[model samples]
Target: MTPIQALYYFVEARPTRTGPPNVGIGAILLIVAAAVFIAWVAWLWIAARPSSGGEETALNLQPYLSDDELETTKLNRVLRAAM
Candidate 1:
């Protein structure tokens, strides 16, 4: 047989000296980097986005709760305190 054939046979027949390399950390790091990059791009895209034709300031969200809701909250707080 040719030298190349002998080498191939030896390599194929011999057992591998080392088991599969540990790539979990590298894969996790790669995923984390990709996520971070994606997040950064999304943040930049949102920041540089053009504003709609409207008021510059955003509306505040503040709706007062009903009396019954307040009373229920108070009762829950009291029960929590008792516990």
Candidate 2:
């Protein structure tokens, strides 16, 4: 009569089937989905590959500006404005 007992009974009870279980379409769909996913990943990997003839650009970093100094300067400006 309790909720747990009812749930347990529901899970334990099996319905009588007149025919065989149909899983052929489901299996085929699963295989197709897996193949599509793999193909997509392979395509992305191939498309994103860097060209052999392209030259790599050098990164330019400012030597005069330090991150810590920049942060301190911003904090000082905010504090001065607040005062």
Candidate 3:
């Protein structure tokens, strides 16, 4: 009816802004993103695992010892006990 309304309608071509001009993004991109995220998380999880090696070294830390360090350790323990 008004000149400004007519001009606006003609310029806009559409009455209201369409949410989207057309459909949407394809599913492939979403799938790729999910795969990449999963792979990244898996790599981080694997890298975080402890890689402690040498069973003999681990056993040396225990109380049972056939080495000379055990005598000094026992003496220290006795001194602490005496104190």
Candidate 4:
């Protein structure tokens, strides 16, 4: 017999057990939960990483402005936006 057919027959030849079938259900749920947890962690890790592009670096202006100047700039921006 071919390996595939032999393996199939081996799987089909297992004796049936008379008991509550909760083990299979619990195993399936555990696998699903682990998959979901892994996906969530992967998403969080990806999102927490800084982008490789220059956009974020270009937007940083803290080094060029004093506190007072920053506050004034903010006020001016708000006033301009209000108009």
> Model 2: how far is 47 from its true place, Å?
0.8
Candidate ordering by TM-score (highest first): 4, 1, 2, 3
Best by TM-score: 4
Residue 40 error for model 2, in Å? Answer: 0.4
The TM-score measured for candidate 2 stands at 0.38
Best by lDDT: 4
Candidate 2: where is the Cα deviation over 4 Å?
1-23, 54-83
Off by over 4 Å in 1: 1-18, 56-83
Write candidate 1's Cα lDDT for 1-83 as tens digits. Answer: 99999999999999775766667788989999999999999999999988886855445555567789878998789989999
Evaluate model 3: give its lDDT: 0.82
Write one digit per residue (lDDT tens) for candidate 2, span 1-83.
99999998998896877996776788989999999999999999999998897765655643656889878998799989999
Q: Tell me the lDDT of model 4 at 17.
A: 79
Candidate 1, run of 10 with poorest lDDT: 55-64
- Return whichever of 2 and 4 wins on lDDT: 4
Per-residue lDDT of candidate 3, residues 5-80 (tens digit): 9998898896776586554566667888999999999999999998876546566576776567767888789989
TM-score of each model, paired residue for residue = 0.38, 0.38, 0.34, 0.40
Q: Clashing residue pairs, candidate 2?
A: none
At residue 3, candidate 2 shows an lDDT of 100
